[model samples]
Target chain A: MVSITEGKPLEHTLEQLSTTREVTILSCNTCAHYCGTGGRLAMDHLAFHLNNNGVTVVGKELVTKVCIQEQLRGCNHTKTIVLMACSSGLISAKEAWPDAVIVPTNSTLGIGSYDPDTGSATLLFPFPGHETSRGARFPSLNTEAIR
Target chain B: MIMTLRRLDYHALIAFLPRDARVLVWSCNTCARLCNGFGGKEATKALCSMLAEDGLEIVGGEVLSVSCFKSVIRKRLDRADLRMMAEKATHLIPLTCRTGVEMMRNELPWLEIVEVGETVGLGYLSESRGAVLTNSIVEMLDLPDEGIPLSEVAEDLGLFLGPFER
Candidate 1:
């Protein structure tokens, strides 16, 4: 998975969303923080980027999780709602505000592992066809196999 | 300082070490913590333990806010303390980002420095209700793939610790 900065993709996503006047950037602190990505930092950086682009970012919120029902209430706005979390977050945000344009800032990558030596999360690329061998190999596998 | 977003080069830094030498573990608490690197207090302790197990003598370990930000203070107030610590160590293993490493290099021209983490600004990937799913794209979309190797993590830790020193 390509790990590009939100700043690199901000202009493109904004253009695609066709955000003219005001925009609302919403970030989920829970997921992004755990992932080693910018949960709060992304919101601040994006706000700065939008303001510099001559677009007025009306609202910015960094909730525990944007997918949750409680935080979905105040997210509804007439302007485009940009989600700085993952693709799943974008889907949930879109579900809440059907009318508002939901744009995703993060490219969905597979499960990643934190590298202790480098102090960065390394994307754990799933090996294709490894799942098929598991079911076919053993007759009666353990509960772990099913999961 | 040049602000370039790149992962830490642990291998390169390790290669610079001479066989098995005494080293001091230094961590940055601010930027490194923000980047999810080895600048945090917990990470500094872990690094010291890991290094000690690897047959390297750890003289001491310290967690500074920003070595560069306090370069003047580090040079003046902390100079005697640093000099005393430097005398006991063979090298300064900076468990900080590249910027911190660079700052230390410039400030202490005679001191040997090594960096342990990347300088990239951690970016957001995903979110889940109970679990904070940062980088799980496949499971998030429910696509079938060999999921995360939860079983291997224990084995990896065992390997990291080395054969039980009996």
Candidate 2:
């Protein structure tokens, strides 16, 4: 299974994605859900934080099985849809709506062992193409951190 | 819909099984299949063959629609043939996520249901490699009960407690 840790902070992505336009957050309910990245609560957290910060969150969706392109089709086709899922989910969103600006909020990591006894996931081998860092855009509080 | 999985160290599974105890393996084609656990009929077949080579008698196995659904598994168990196989087998192994194991365990409390894979975290697979984890899981673990004290888990599983565990 794919086990990943959050890469970039939500504030960083929001700084770019929420700049003057309304943004929608697409959360994945499958692996992204299990990883705790794009689940309902995480998506809600992002939306709430962004909305509070003057970023108009136009839409918020929880996508099931984000990796499957078929499942990701026909989602919010607004100008910008902030993807709270993995690289695959981002790609699927992009594929489905080429015109819509799909921005990924989370950084993708590889699969590893997870001990519920501990709050950490052991990501030994990482999946290639996980360099989804949009680069350090804004020095801000880590809104999406699991604290 | 949360697809997370781990490859079972057939060695570890074998080490625990009683001598000559026949086994029945179950897998799902939903999330576990994507995580590389035996989630499909093909995967179940191949795993069965491999275990058979290891001197373990695998009676039969199946790849159901979703092994995590307790109702689904209960329905499958309703079939006389499946019920007979499960009853006859000494142990039942689920080549699925932890939830899938729970599904089997919930239905068949009397049978010894071994977990073939660890329910690590939830994520999807593009290739046959690693998957992406979610932020919600970390937040969930941040809660009191979900935290892994490492040492305690190690001690409970006897891993790094007195011996190196599988």
Candidate 3:
């Protein structure tokens, strides 16, 4: 099963990072990657956009699985972190770095099953309160994504 | 890891299938496996053996890396040997989480799918305490600060700890 999430609006993410001096972008390359929210490509794109918009992206860490608390411990020691993983990953980061300012860029929809042939994931079994999203297809973050 | 519990006992499971049922045992090797050996290669083998002893026609036993991926399940089902095995089967017994069982249903609509696992919530593997439930979609919302152990959660829910037993 895959943990599914949708990227927050670009404007909202930028606003959250507006006051930060230097921020680290932490992305998970597994389920989030499959969901097109948190991955190497997404991280790099976000970093580039942030840099172009006068924001200093100090670091970009692409963890294989950020939900694992141990794996999340290696994130850059920045004051602000723009986390691009699911809520579970965000919780792990919070537990790992209690003092750091963690900003989430994705909304956890729930768990899903991926279809490699279609390169898409369906929200088969949603988390609590996300029952309406069950059977919903993967979100298109392409609009919010910076080219 | 995704936490799951045995949804049916062996007796209940056997009685649910048709009299002339040809069974194909399917299992997931990831989260379900971590759930106290709930679903995995070994679990599949054990269930298959038990069914055979009960005089059921066991078509075959298959193990998936992650049954939650429809593509993975579909790819495996498309294989010539697997397709033949599936063709010979009337009912699919899945030793996987509910999501995995649902994917099997979507891919193989022709066969009657038998779900034996009930997915509870998501959890992480703990070095000292085993699998711990962190996010639950079910009733167990007030988990401990460090999260509740999957075994404890299963026990509290009146569910089986592992694979079906004969």
Two-chain DockQ for each candidate model: 0.04, 0.07, 0.36
For candidate 2, the clash count comes to 21
Could you tell me the lDDT of residue A32 within candidate 1?
A: 50
Off by over 4 Å in 3: A14-19, A53-55, A68-80, A96-101, A125-135, A145-147, B10-21, B53-55, B139-147
Question: A1-147, model 2: which lDDT tens digit per residue?
Answer: 344546366567756764566887888875566566768887787777777778788888777867665666566546888787765566546656678877787766654434333433445335445334222221113434422
lDDT of 3 by residue, A1-147 (tens): 787787888788889877876888998898888888878988998898888887799899999877666676546758888898877677667777779999998888777777777878778667767889898777554548535
The TM-score measured for candidate 1 stands at 0.41
Predicted complex 1: CAPRI docking category? incorrect
Candidate 3 per-residue C-alpha lDDT over B39-58 given as tens digits, one digit per residue, 9 for 90 to 100: 89999999999888888999
Fraction of true contacts kept, per model?
A: 0.00, 0.05, 0.33
Error in Å for residue A85 of model 1: 12
- Cα-based lDDT at residue A20, candidate 2: 61
C-alpha lDDT (0 to 100) for residue B100 of candidate 2: 67
Across B1-166, the per-residue lDDT of candidate 1 in tens digits comes to: 1111222334444456776677877766643443323355776777677667667788777777554343332644366776677677778876554545765676556667764443321222212322122322232222212222211221322311111111
